[model samples]
Target chain A: MTNQLSLQQRIQMAFPGLAAAYSVDGLLHYRVEKSRIPELTQFLHEKARGRLALLFAVDCRPLAEKYEIQYLFAFASDHPWVLLTIELAGQDRLFTSITPSVHAAQWYEREIRDLYGLIPQGHPDLRRLVRHEHWPKGTHPLQKAFPWNKTIGRQQADYRFRHIEGEGVFEVPVGPIHAGIIEPGHFRFSVAGEPIMQLEVRHFWKHRGIEKLFEQQTLSTAIALAERVSGDTTIGHSLAYCQAAETLLHIDVPRRARYLRSLFLELERLHNHLGDVGAICNDTAYALAHAHCSRMKELLLQLNDRLTGSRFLRGAMAIGGVTKDVSAIELSEIVALLDGIEKDFAELESIIFANASLTDRLETTGVLTERTGWDHGVVGVVGRASGIDQDVRRDRPFAAYDEVPVNISLYRYGDVRARLRVRMDEIHESIRLIREIRANIPQGPVAPAAAHRPQPGQWALSAVEGWRGEILYFVMTGEQGSIHRCKVRDPSFVNWPAIQWAVVGNILPDFPLINKSFNLSYAGNDL
Target chain B: MFRILKKSLKTGIVTGQHPHADQPAESPSQAVCEKAMPFRQSLTIREVDTGSCNACEMEMNALANPIYDIERFGVHIAASPRHADALVVTGPVTVNMERALKDVHKQTPDPKLVIALGDCAINCGVFKGSYAVTGPVDRHIPVDVRIPGCPPRPAEILKALEEIRRPASWK
Candidate 1:
């Protein structure tokens, strides 16, 4: 609290014309003059030691006579989130771009430009981000005037991808529909022979207008919507959404529910990470590791079905707390499952590590340097694997993470093996965390039946360290507690762009392994 | 090297029998005869994700796991649509993927069945009336079979595969 108070004062003193500063839902809300954004971002990012976690634009028309752009800066240590809001007049569309100084805002600015039609004046590479070629020109869906369900006729437009031209320079265009059974996303690789010159990922093929759909959902109905944001990250996204909604409505989750929520989150991580480990191995043509890993994953999924009634943990989360409770028998079953997985996973890990050929394929392949990871604002497992020591559960504790500590093993290799080790380490950590929750879980109601309402125009920013990385949700309330604007920033949004850099020097074939290593969600990002 | 071999030997064979493994292969159903796509011993499927949440895809991937091992049932996931007997399309057809889906359908050889997997693909499910969505898989392409569930369990998917492989057994 003292640190939060001082940080507020420090920010106030730092920015002389800081219009308003207040604390709500553990977020230090600061409103400043529109011109001071870049400077404030620089100050917060550099001197204040903050990371640009989220940057999103809110359509504040009707209620307020302007569009509000919010910049959320999170600290490495335990500090209240500094939410900087800049108001743009209803007519104004241009704002000074912060991408020149703080590189993380690059995609956010472009996404705002695409969805809200807000032009970040000096943003380099101002291409249409979320908009596909067929998307009609001048039609910003996030604006209050543009109805959510209004269909627009397709139009012809050309997107010029940055081309690397030379004698041996070859451009390979892949996907929208890939050979594998994965989500759609096009990748343009500029490769000279085998080693790639540049890998440009053109995604959003799976864009379901998810954020726009959120506006139509009430606080209660949005949790299901949030679960679909990224299928694998159902608990992570739903938990973040619930946390945001609970904060917005001032709903106090029961103690037992918090621990149960943690249990479910860890289980989600356990299964996803387990699957990913196998996937990474499978990519390297190690079918043995893949087979055993898949076996372990299937076992975990069955356990999930037995406990929560959903293999993917879909209906387990609710706005106030968790929807389902784990009985004593179920808890024991979870423990037993974890014990088996822990043992199997240990052997699997040894089998994987002991294989020289597999390690050779994994090590130094698709290396995403720590510097590149940080510059592109990568988070989650990829960020940690690349030496950016940040875990939302540890840094910004949510659910039962606040009570029980998390152990994060940092990796500096920033390669396929490093990413594998990160997932591997997290698997062990998740097992330990689950054990901690099971041991210390208190007895109480899972969720209260009482309904709560939010004050119109109130907003809350929630982030969860999902299996992939950070799944962030910025939810704003409207009249009668409707979801005004729910901005879902999956870790894929930031980490996707960084993949292009990772594959720069790597061979074209290694791209899949690199991609599989990150396993960034196409639906989550495209949404 | 020996460690991996030892581990594999220690793990032993974990692949389970497919759904309806007890039943003998039957002739193609009347509907299948009308479509002119005969039920074969092997059913090669090409999966195309239109706009799924990837939950459907995860379950689709699970079919290959030890518990299911769909390949044991002669259900192979082909790399290309041209090689596939059935096209397994997941999610509601989105505008961006509309052309791609159509093109993929076109690329599939003649007498190929188009199967809409998961609730999203069947009826657009939760993403129902969104502007970005064109409609269900049936709206874009002629669908032969529909597998329902937000993401149908791997067993359910295996059942569908069995039906595709032996349409006569599917009442």
Candidate 2:
């Protein structure tokens, strides 16, 4: 609380007459002049030392005659989020770009330009970020006037991919459709001999207009959409969305439900991390580790199905609390399952580390230095692997994280091996967390009987540290308590840009290994 | 190496029996069964993701894992569409991927089948009315079979493929 107060004082000292209101929701809203974005965000990012977590635009027209741009900076300390708001009149379509000063604002600026048609005046690369070539010009889907179901005619426009031209430099284009059973995105690699010189990823091939679709949904129905934001992080996204809804609706979740939410979040993490550990080994042609890991992952998914009705743990999270409660018998069953997997995982971990050949492929392969990680604002396991040493569960505790303190595993190597180690460590930690939650879990009603309607114009920002990274949701309630604008920042949005830097000097075949190490979500990023 | 060998030996064979080993084949699937008759013996599948949340892809990948190992039943995921006997597609066809979906469908040769792998692919489940959606897989291509579920379980998917692979037994 003192840290938050001092931070507010510092911000007030920096900007005279700014009147930065620090609300109970942990948001310090500074509604500033449009011209002050670059300086304000740079000051907060560098001086205040906050990670630029999310930047998005809300089309507040018809309700209000302006487009509100929100730049949310999350702190490594107990300090609250500094939300820098720049409202532009409906007629004014431009705001000064903060990308030149604060590098993390690059994609957010371009995305705002694409979705809301609010151009960032001085952005360096203003080429299309979200929209494809065929999307008709002047069709900003997020605007209030644009109906969600309206169809626009397609147009032809060529995309200009970054070119590296020289002798022995060859360009290889791969996938809007990959050979593997994964989501689609195009990768253009500029390679010479074996090592890649520059790699550009063209994505958003799976944009289902999810953000606009949120506007048409009530708060209850929106949880289903949130669960699908990234299927792998089903609990993570829905939990964040539900927390935001709970905050807006002023519904307090019961103690047992909060504990269950934490437990399930760890379960989701365990399965994904275990799968990646096996996948990274599989990329190196080590089939033994892959086979065991796949079996372990299958067992975990089956357990999830037995406990919750969904293998991926969808429909597990509700608005005020979790949908289902675990009985003593089910909890014992989970304990038994974890006990068996714990021994199996230990043996598997030994085998993986024991093999020098497997370790060689992982070490020094696809290194994303700590500096690069910070520059790109990478979050989650990828960021921790690169020595960021930040976890939202510890930094800003949510659910039952406050009661059961989180132990974060960090590495500085920032290589494929570093990423693998981080994941392995996290699996161990998740197992520990589940055991802790089961032992200390309080007995109570899972959810409240009814949730009161949120007032229009009320908004809340919720962040959950998903298995992949940090999943942030900025939700606002509109008239009739409908979702006004729900901006989802899947960790992939920030982390995807950093992959280009990671694969620079690496060989082409090692690309899959490095890519799998990160395992970013295309559906999440595209949405 | 000794540890791996020991572990492998101790674990022993884990491959399970086929979905229809104990009982007779259930009723033949819908109209798609006639179309599925050709690939009854062995089937090569090419999985395409139009715009799914990736749950379908997760289950599809699970089919290849040691537990399911659909390969024992002569079902394989081909590296290229050209080698595929059927295209197992997932997701509601997004506008961005509409052209690519058609191009992939066109590339598959004659007597090829298209299976819409999840609820989203069959009818754009939750994303039906969104402007960015072009529609389901059937809107773009003629779907031979539809596997229903937010993402169908690997066992359920195996049973469907088994029915497709052995349509005559069910008939």
Candidate 3:
């Protein structure tokens, strides 16, 4: 990670044609032309910099005028993020492509195309990534003028993937409707019954226009919007959004608030990771582990309810301070619960690990080579399992994480087992953090933030290493009242490609297990 | 087999009962429709994407998780304008979602309660004016309940729901 790219440096390096660094709070954003996105993405990917940050598009005709789409990129080696821009003309415009350089860009590019109709030419697979097949193609729902009654104008031509047509090469089209209640993603599996030759994913059942709605809106409102980017990653997304807002406003949360925020974020990871570990066991048909993990997760939820007053710890965070304060009785109760859950989780995980059948199923199942993982720039448990040693909390800390250290777990064998191990170990670490934060809970106003923050044109970013990985937020003020632009990048966006690589040789039954191994949020991606 | 027997004896009854001793949400058939809030009821909410990027919906569903157990409240998301109640909306209600919001509101069962939860819903929190969203839930829907916070906690959601249920006299 030597000679890392700072915000300005990264943007300069990635998009050399782009010039000038515009300071927004502490983060630097380079406002570059839209035409050079593909080249920039290629350059960044070549260096194995990091995952594609996020694609943000907004229609500002109502406010200050331009209808623009901004693309943000981050480097794991350093905290620098490049913000590239494209202003769509005539209220409707299209842009170039970047899928060729990064295969992971296939879905993201399609998503951008579907929402904004900014066609990413040269994208190998330009199929719908979020909207269902029935959705109108040219509508681009996220665009400003697209009417709500926007129906499918023309029946989207049947997606014609390069079908393998030989005696042995057969097609396996799995559902837009899957067996599990997993999000709607159509997988076109090219296989010899079980062995997958090539896999193509047609996504977009959950396309909800989030960016189009944020124009001329306040930063506070967007945080909740950000929270819903992914259900499991609420704390992470909120932390990122708040960090961006606070950075843009040049405000900081109290130490107590910061500690409390981290506590909830880590607790979120604890609960989710526990469910993942248990779910993997359930995948192996190990009944006890499922029941035990479910119970442990349940207990943790109860603790969240008692401490944060919300099972998922949503609304617990605020831009300046926390919404709810940790009470003494609640903290002690949570400590006890965490202790019990930790003990049980540890014992249950050991028992599951001890069982050779469970290990056999998980050991080599859904393996993602480190090279492929790095190439896609995967994050969280998915990347950790694959031995891609990059974590935002340790690399760049925000909120209470700055004070509390994280011991990131890693194993060279990037499989379900490694993911499970990361989940288990992270839980242990979270437990310790919960106890520590609770013990040192400071006394202060959990609510001290001002009514409204700085005037328009200020920009800032706050990065929090949410349960998934790093949740980064970029905020720009406009109208001296509302947000000009906001970008949300979930860990799932980074890990979705890695999951595709993992699914290559896996049995279709194991697809769910492998998919869960990298549980990317459909809502986050769709938005 | 003997060790299994010993362990079973050591750890009794891991399985139990209820809403019926098992899991409620797991099986759609088993869920008893206790006090159904059918779409025909007073408030008809039309969900508009209003370009939020989609974090609020994820949590909105989390309310129904077996743990938080929001189904017991008889609150559920509406599919289309035909069957709707106060649109419990999320995100910044992005511009892309604004038109959809308006049409949906137009389509709802009327006397709709617009409970705006999450920061994005209220004032476009993070994405204030991204040249995307036109404004908050109020700019589009006649918002009644404004639940603030970046993305209000699920408890906040429950609180907003309860608040919407209250009559103006109670306020």
Candidate 4:
């Protein structure tokens, strides 16, 4: 605690112009002039090595007569999260862009422009990110003035995609709609002969105005909305939202509930990772391995259905605690199911590893260099494969992760095989963690006594390590305990840009295989 | 490869008996079932996800796995819409996907059936009031069958497909 306090003092000493520097709700909140944001962010990234976890703007017109932009940073060594807040007067609508120094701020800045209409001066690519071309200009959806259900009638306009010209270069436009049962995303590849010269990606086609919908709902009903942000990540997103709400109200979750939360999270990781291993094999024409993997994945889903009514594990998380409690019988059933799955998975892996051609195809295809990964701040298995060894579960402990330590898998290859290896290892680790959690299951009430309503002008940031990577939720309370603003950042939002860098120099035909290896969520990224 | 063959021989026939057995006496009168006489039982399907969270798609993919192997029932997921007899769509149709969904429906050969899977495709499900969602699949195309669930179970999905493939008079 003293170290954290001195760290706050050091930051204040470093930046004398900061208006106030104090710890609020266990997080160091520093308020500075809007002009000092870029310089302070640069110092944090380069000198202090603080990773930018989230950056978003909040419309505070009614309460403060200003728009507040928050930058959340997480330190690796101490696992402390600090918030740098800049309150801009309603009259002044522009702020300096930090994308030049911190490359990960590119998409966040662009999103603020599209949703809040806040201008980021000198952004390298100032194009519409969340809203499409048909959306009316200057009608920012996240502003207080814009109604939640406002329908701006569509109009057709040309969206300019970057083009390359040469003697032999040609462009290949693939999908906002693909053939298979996958979500919609557009990819434009500039190719010369067999090699791709450059790849441009355009997503947010599935954007359903989720943040706007959150504003209209109360704290209790917002969990259902958060679960729908990405179907595959129901538990992950819902847990982060509940944690944020819990923090805002200063409620303490039961020890038993925290253990149950970790158990469900591992179950999600197991099923998803198993499916990915199979999908990657199927892409390489190995149908047998895929069939076996699918069997294993289905078994897990059945267990989840038995534990919770929904197969996707929805309706299990509530604010301050979990909704469903796991009985002794159900816990034993999970262990028995895991025993059978572990054996089958081992057999499947042996067969997969025995195949030389499959391994050959995955070894060196679609390499994303470690330098590129760091520059972009990629998360989850993708970053681990590229030698960026940071997992939110380990660095910033949440839920029962502090009790049950996580062993992060790392690979320096930065290829398809490396990513596959990371998933495989994580699957095993999750299995072990589940077993440990089941054994040490504590005895206590699952839910809190009563739901605590948050006071106005209070905010909290919560992070949960989803199957893909880190999921962040920033919640702010308005008058009468209503949610003023909620910002959800799925790991896909950060990793999707890395795919464009990964696909370069690779043949176009191998694009699908490389993409399945990443297996990013379109709905999560788009939202 | 020899070991693989030996294991296959030991496993014997893992395929289901759904196709060879007689159609159930209480078969429901669904679009697929109406056209599914004994002579014309085989079918092909093409799946599209408009804007789902991908949970429904996971269940759809599970239909091909060993447990509920729809291939045993003579149903195959076709690579192209041209060869597919039924189009299975999921999620609440997003504004951007409206054009693609209509184009896919147009490209499919005649005598095609549209099966709206999950609650989202049926009536926009959880995302009923978002600005980006155009609405349910039926709003754009005529849906022959609607399987409703947050995400329908694999067994439920199989039952619906089985119902669709029965004779029209069976109901």
Query: For residue A193, what is the lDDT in candidate 2?
Result: 94
Docking class of 4: medium
**CAPRI quality level assigned to candidate 1 from its DockQ score:** medium
Model 3, docking class: incorrect
Computed on alpha carbons, the lDDT of every model, listed in order, comes to: 0.87, 0.89, 0.65, 0.85
Best by DockQ: 2
Model 2 residue A218 lDDT score: 92
List runs of model 3 lying over 4 Å from the truth. Answer: A1-19, A23-26, A33-41, A47-51, A58-71, A76-79, A85-96, A147-156, A451-453, B1-171
The sequence of per-residue lDDT tens digits that candidate 2 reaches over residues A178-239 is 98888999999999999999999999999999999899999888999998888888999999
For residues B69-93, what per-residue lDDT tens digits would candidate 4 score against the true structure? 8888899988788888989999998
lDDT of candidate 1 over B1-171, digit per residue (tens): 687777778878877733322232233356854453463657888999999999999999999888788888888888888898889999999988999999999999988888888899999988988878889999878888777888888887776666556545445
Native-referenced DockQ of model 2: 0.72
Task: Please write out the lDDT profile of model 3 over residues A62-179, one tens digit for every residue.
Answer: 5545666666666654555556667766644567767667765666677677666776667777666555454454566655566533334335346666577777878888754343
Q: Order of all candidates by TM-score, from best down to worst?
A: 2, 1, 4, 3
Model 1 alpha-carbon drift over 4 Å, by segment: A1-6, B17-29, B33-39, B167-171
Q: Tens digits of per-residue lDDT for model 4 on A69-126?
A: 9898777645367888898796888999999999989999999999889999989999
The stretch of ten residues in a row with the least summed lDDT in candidate 1 chain A is: A17-26
Model 4 residue A16 CA deviation (Å) reads 2.6
TM-score of the second chain for every model: 0.86, 0.89, 0.67, 0.83
lDDT of 1 by residue, A1-527 (tens): 78877787888798776755777646788788888888899998878877788999998877988999999888866687888888998588889999998888888898999999999988898988788878988878889889888886799888899998889999999997888899999999998999999888898888889989999999988888889988999999999999999988888889999999999888889999999999999999998788898898888888888777788988999878888889988888788878988988898888888888998999999888988888788898899899998888888888988999899989999998999999999999999998888899999899977566778898888888888888888899998979999999999998998998888889989999999999999999999
